[model samples]
Target: MQIQDLPYPDPGVPDAHSGPRFLWWLGRNQLGGQLKSLAWGLLHFTSVTGLPFCVGFAIQAVVDRSGARLALSGGLLALCGMLIALGDTFLHRAAVTNWITAAARVQQLLARKTAQLGSALTRRVAAGEIVAVSTGDVEKIGWFVEAVSRFTAAALSVVFVCVALVVYQPALGIVVAVGVPILALAVLPLLPRATRRADFQREKAGRATELASDTVAGLRVLRGIGGEELFLDRYRAASQEVRHAAVRSARMWALISGIQVLLPGLLLITVVWYGVGLARDDRITIGELVTVYSAVMLLSYPLRHFEEIAMAYSFSRPSAKRAARVLSLERATDTAGSLDASVPSGDMHDPATGLLVPAGRLTAVVCGDPDAAGRLAERLGGHAAEEASSDTSVRLGGVPLDELPLDSARTAVLVQDKDPVLLSGTLRELLDVPGSGDITPEEALAAAQCGDVLEALIQGSLDAADPMDARITERGRSLSGGQRQRLALARSLITDPEVLVLDEPTSAVDSHTEARIADGIRSLREGRTTVVFTSSPLLLDLADRVVLVHEGEVAAVGAHRELVHGEPRYRAVVTRETDEEAAASLGEVLDGGVVEGGLRDGVRDGGAAKHDPPKKDSHQSHGSKHGKPTLSDVLNELEEIEETA
Candidate 1:
């Protein structure tokens, strides 16, 4: 595959059995590219190996005083030089092409695996390992693949030079041929220890990379808890360990390099010693001795590739294995059935949890165990296991979810995970979802109660009022958790699918803001099939029906209020203790006069009547700058009112 045609329409199934096999598979897949590289490599090596022979021939012609022969030798020398130039240029191009295409193919395979596995990928592999594989591992794998042709050509040239020597002078040819293998094998015994050291280095580096990624991801939390120094020290230690391991591995390779130089130098001396004796005894011509000497010296260059190829294999073997392990993973769900002609659009049912979500109604699921809830949510969204078990299926519209085409299943249902990521882009781009849905981007944002989110974006950017055009940093890091959660919710709401499964949709927001979001969602999705997995009383109160998931199965189904009053377990799970505590918390908000007597129930009530609008103040005076009340301005106005009251 060419670099331009990347993301190969299909990277095709990888072998994935072992590293060597995987490498072979990669080579086989790019057979055409490999052949082109091999051809160029052969041309380059042949020209290099032929140069010494041309020089020896020139010396013979000069000694014979044959002018025509001298001219012929000069022409041949020029031809060799031209071939070398052409070969060098084309070889570079071919090697580069091979390297880039191989890397692209591996990258595509990894990307496909990531999409297929979703969040499960991290569960199976370390985030650092994945990152390392995608970056450094990919390059190493491509390097070995690109070196294969060069190594093969070098080996061939070594053999050809040895054969030419034997034809010219048998006594010296035997010594040269025998000594080359000795030089190549001298480093072989050291390779195993070297490989082990390299593996250790790679492992330590992966750990360091993982630590760095985790540290960056939690930097805000670390700062809040004053743990930044602790994490930094830990990362510093990990980096040191990686550095030590790398130095050790480098020492082993350096020893191998020293041997490569020493043995070849000794072998060249032996060949020259034998050739000089043959010339002195009149057993071989002086010109033949020069040819023998030149050939032996030329063979040293190709011999170096033998050691290089060994090193390449050693490094790339582990890299290929890691990449193969990642690519071999298949999604839990089976998507092989081509039965999309008709889909049963009815209530959604999960056999594992025995929870049924009736069509055209909002159902809330409350599970004591969040892990169980997440798993159930996965099944509900058609992410079933590969092998069907008794508890494996979730039926949507009376149809087995796994039977639907992958795309069809996705369009039919959308599960907004608890920690959805907001990719780096403007607000408009973030919300521009793909799939047929009736919900407009504006409608979804409003339904998720994202007024503050919009204001935060505008305040943090040059743009003021146009939230649609405001830029968001990667993963929405600039926003608070609540803001990020709300933005993710809005993105999901934009899809407006036939079935929406939300897992802890309001976990990050305050009770007041969550209440408003709950109210807005209910109103926006009045007639749609929506399932919310949350135990928040505010959200539970808004559901058309509440299902209590106990011990991994449905225990009761009823109205939120009825369950709260009648079921002690449900009450314990969904509500705080005693009315006194609830009353006391509300009293604290009012007595402290925190932000408009803390009557900011407009955040949850979904109505302006509950919380009066902030009176005009200095902050409000500048609100018209953005053609609207910026979120910060509204917040400041409320604080002013609270202080005055």
Candidate 2:
């Protein structure tokens, strides 16, 4: 593939069994580019080596004082200069092309893997590692790939020069050849130490990158909690650690460089000392001495490639391995069985939890454990978590979900995660997701109750009130939490899938706004399969059926109102209360009052309420023996603290 035709039509699956194998795979894929680079490199170095020969011949012509010979030598020198200029220019072009194409191919493979595995990939790999791989690691891999042909050509040129020297002067050539090998191989013994130091530097750098990424992601939260300086100090220490490791690595490399210069200088001195003796004895001409000396100087250039190749391999090997590991990951539900290609219009069932989402109904799942609910939501959409059992499965229309291809499964069932990402783009572009049809941006925005979101977008930009063309910053960071969440919901609703699974879609919104969204979703997806995972009362009340998951099992299935009255487990989980609290709150709940104790006086509907001051005996200590605070318990404590303040 040409460099311009980047992101290959099918970048093809990578051979990720090992780092070396992956490097081999990259070379094989871009053989054409490599060959072009090789040809240019050979031409460039050949011309460079010829320059010393031309100078030697020119000197001979001047000594003879022959006009014809001088003219011939000058012509040859000009030809060599032209070749050198042309070769240098083209060689650089070819080498850079190889670098860009190789990097692009690896990036394409990574992009495909990311899309194939989705959030599952992040669970298996650190986000920082992925970031490092895509940025710095890619360049190192490309550097090695681009260096291969140039190094080969440089070695070949050195060999050619040595052969020419031996043919020109036997005794001088012998001394020079022996010293060149020693100069190149003398540093090999020290490389292992250098590689170890380099590896440590890379590790520390990765840690620093991860720390910086986390700090940036949580900057808003850190500022709120007055912990920005704490994290900044930690990062400063990490940065210092990286610096120290890099300095250690650089010290080893500097030593290697010093040895390289010392050995070559000694070899050059020895060649000149011997050549000068040969000249005095009339065994070699002055022209021959100059040529031998020039050839030795030229050999130093190729010797540097040995060190470069070593350093490149040291850094790139681990990088390729990380990329390979990411590419090798497969979804837990990915199976080799033939896909059930026939699309079906029937109920979706989760055999593990015995929860069924009947066709043409809105279902809500309630669980005390938010983590469990999130896992169930994934399974419901045919995405098996890494930790989930392989034997456990979900089915749609009597066909096993694992039997269906990924694209088909996604088309049939779409899952909207709790923290859905709103990629940077215009509002219209964000809503214009893949496979979205018929539903206009306005329709989705309406269904998601996104009027306030549109207002926010309009106010942030110079665009018209339509807000479709308003730009969203990366991850929609400029928008409030509720605005981002609503925009994500709108994007999901626009897809109009056969089955929609949402996890806590309204968690960030107020109850009044959430009620509107629930109503809008019910109206828009009136006859579709919609499964919402949430414990919010507004959304639960809107579901056609509410399934209560207790202790990782389905404890009850009924209307939200019916379950509250019939099943104490359901009530306790929903209200986040103890069994005793749930029983005692029944009367107040029946009277339409809040589940927690009465609000402070004059607190209106949905208004924040102050908490009562805690008694010394009521204070919950860090070493308290009770279980971790439930959602209800946390909210109550927050209120109590607010009142005390």
Candidate 3:
């Protein structure tokens, strides 16, 4: 059956009630296997119980007549023992199979849910929590499932043995039967405490997993900032919390275990005491007394499952809740009717920023904050908005983005991040994304400036015809930072999305390589609407138009050179250099002397302008006559100039 077709109850708010429902749901799904296991467990337990009865009969026969009859009874007892041994081995095998299969089915359900939720999975649950649920939680749930049949067999054995005793000796039989249930149910009071502690421990463990995953993901950045020690300390603290939680959980379990052992022992003593009294009174046979004791002893085994099932349920219920939370994440809306998978052909517009990205044009978005750029990119790509801003609207060809089907929207707009994931595979396989064969690998590689990557791939024995056959290590860990970024860019380019949104695509590469890639991308994506969010001068210079964003609003829109010369704030923000020439020009204007440098030099001289023409050695020698000015000095001068103008 298809994964989608698998039956799963909407595990509503996992709590005490949900645990039973989950088990019922699992049983319903695997009814055949469960029934088989139950039958085998009953058969095996019955055979084991029969051995004690056979021994009692043999002893009684020997007492009554020490001839052929006693020998016949002894042989019968030996045969029963062998049968009991054989049944037990098969029963154990069947029960274990049931446990493994049940756990596997639950794991499949979780895996399917993860696939359905996709990227939305992380928004609702931690990565570590998912890991814990799939691994540890599934096993615990299986333990409870397997225990069900074992417990059933144990309860039946107790009843069967009690009936035999009653027929043989009523007074002793009643005590054993009545006291077995009391011993089994003795742990009920401790269950609530155990469950609570287990829940707490699982929660803390999930947090520790999340912290570790986050730390590992950002290890490079942490080391770069010399904050690895700080993060490590935080992880240690979280680990300690998890340890304490585990100890708390263990304490409750230990108490329950003590009761499980102590209560059963007490019940056994009570049974023996009553049986011995009947024997001394000459009311019951010695063989009958031994039979009664063996039955009680056998009943203890199943009684343990009762306590264990309670503990397993307590632990698994919270894990199921976590898994359910992840499964509940809503997928992005698919607006294009399922049949309309056609590529979109039009300009992209964001009314929130009053920005128009014209079709067949290269657009550069220069936001003062990197986060703002990233958010905008996410919105344009049809991903969920990171913030709650009703005023913001992204549209394609005048169609509201939200109205478009998710698949179509995604196909039309692609957002390539600075660090895109590279699945383990040969470099050729990595480049071959969806719609790969439509465009030649050579074209995509050239567009992404991947000539060197291609050489490395060939050197590593990657064949063009069987690119997917190449093995990529986990997350492409074998690749350098820049190679990984370029490979991701290449994958996106291969898709040939109608509107491509790139965030700092060239941020990791050197200037020379960045410049080459910038030119190649402009040429390769000539007729597509491409919005590149970057502070790199080479990429900025290649854009047809640059939109400057400040204070969460569009401050200006113009060609890169025009924006550099006309907008002092844009230059300061992008280049991160002081506009000293602009300040000096302001002083000259105030002194009524012609500024020696032109407007380009005035604004570009001291500041780094992303689109400013390359500076010659001679230009560097030129200095402002006024004292060295900072970007703030330029801003102040611009304010004065604006007032005078």
lDDT of 2 by residue, 92-211 (tens): 998898888888888988988888777777778888788888888899889889888888888888788878887888899888777777887899999999989888888888888878
**Superior by TM-score: candidate 1 or candidate 2:** 2
The lDDT for every candidate, in the order shown, is 0.79, 0.79, 0.71
TM-score of each: 0.84, 0.88, 0.80
Candidate order, lDDT descending: 2, 1, 3
* lDDT measured at residue 476 in model 3 versus the true structure, 0 to 100: 70
Count clashing residue pairs per candidate. Answer: 3, 3, 9
**Candidate 3's residue-wise lDDT over 356-424, tens digit each?**
899999999988788788877877776554342324558788776655656676778888875588877
Q: How many clashes in candidate 1? A: 3
Cα error of candidate 1 at position 380, Å: 2.7
Question: Which candidate's TM-score is highest?
Answer: 2
RMSD of each: 7.1, 6.5, 7.0
